[model samples]
Target: MSGLGMFGGTTIKYRNPTYTRDHGSLTLTWTDEWKTLGGCDLQEPTTGTDTKNREGTLSQYTLYMPSGSPVADNAQVRVDGQELQVDGMVLRIPDPLGILPYCKATLKAWKG
Candidate 1:
């Protein structure tokens, strides 16, 4: 599996959310300590809704990470196990004669 097709597609588990502070109350708790890190690729979700989140329904996915792949910034992805949360800044696509540099995360989930 080395044709560079988004790391051969479908296989994601990236977790980076550790901020715990609850003793005097400042409010900051996001504990997700999962680390699997594989040839990630998940792109098949495009549902939207607005109007001030009428009932809530937004599913957007486009996660294909491999280059450097540290995945931080609202990071929490676990495909095939169902757990998606990473919707901001993970875009790092640079392959200007550098072989393969790919990383684009934007997986949002909301259903109600």
Candidate 2:
């Protein structure tokens, strides 16, 4: 809830996650360790030297899962330490888990 102090509430097209008394909070986290943002080519180089930040917008962002998760909408994404709702498409994580600045300079792969 920290988008310039303007949190984009969950979209109406998608409903909030249903919780139960037996279960506390269904805190779901994105596990897209694929090291790739769907298509954002911000992977670091294999030089094994410099690990600077990439100068580009993340082409695609993915939400992580621990199991065979079904496609769901309005899923809450937690970047870095901030928790935010992934509304319809347009994502603006003001407080990203910071960016993988080194991702563009280092040679690695995400298998999440």
Candidate 3:
């Protein structure tokens, strides 16, 4: 967390879905307690085209956590009290130089 000092103050909530069988019907439920991660850097929103061929805002975020952070692709993101969907690919930035030991996850999302 030494190099991540520049990306402090903001906290991002990562939500994961859970499924259960309710009377022979599969029910999906989201966890009430989200995994809160600190030291996240959220970049400014940029305009982009979505899969539906419609114009929308694209936001990129970087999370500073351990190497095996639970946050995964298509995971729900809640920031600034707004729920947002994780779109496209979730990339993991590797430290090839062995300089920074902290794990960084980069995610791009389409803003609704």
Question: TM-score of the candidate numbered 1?
Answer: 0.31
User: What RMSD, rounded to one decimal, does every model reach?
Assistant: 11.7, 15.5, 4.6
For residues 1-112, what per-residue lDDT tens digits would candidate 3 score against the true structure?
Answer: 4554334566889886666899999865677788886766565444533444456655565545544456665667787986665553355556678554544555566655
Report the number of the highest-lDDT candidate.
Answer: 1
Candidate that scores best on TM-score: 3
What is the per-residue lDDT of model 2 for residues 11-77, given as tens digits with 9 covering 90 to 100? 1221234334545656444443312122122222234332236433222343322111222444443
Model 2 lDDT at residue 76 = 42
- Candidate 1 Cα lDDT to native: 0.73
**Cα deviation in Å at residue 102, candidate 1?**
11
Instruction: Give all TM-scores, in the order shown.
Output: 0.31, 0.21, 0.57
Better candidate by lDDT, 1 or 3:
1
Candidate 3 residue pairs in backbone clash: none
Write the number of the candidate with greater lDDT, choosing between 1 and 2.
1
Q: Cα RMSD (Å) between model 3 and the true structure? A: 4.6
Model 3 TM-score is 0.57
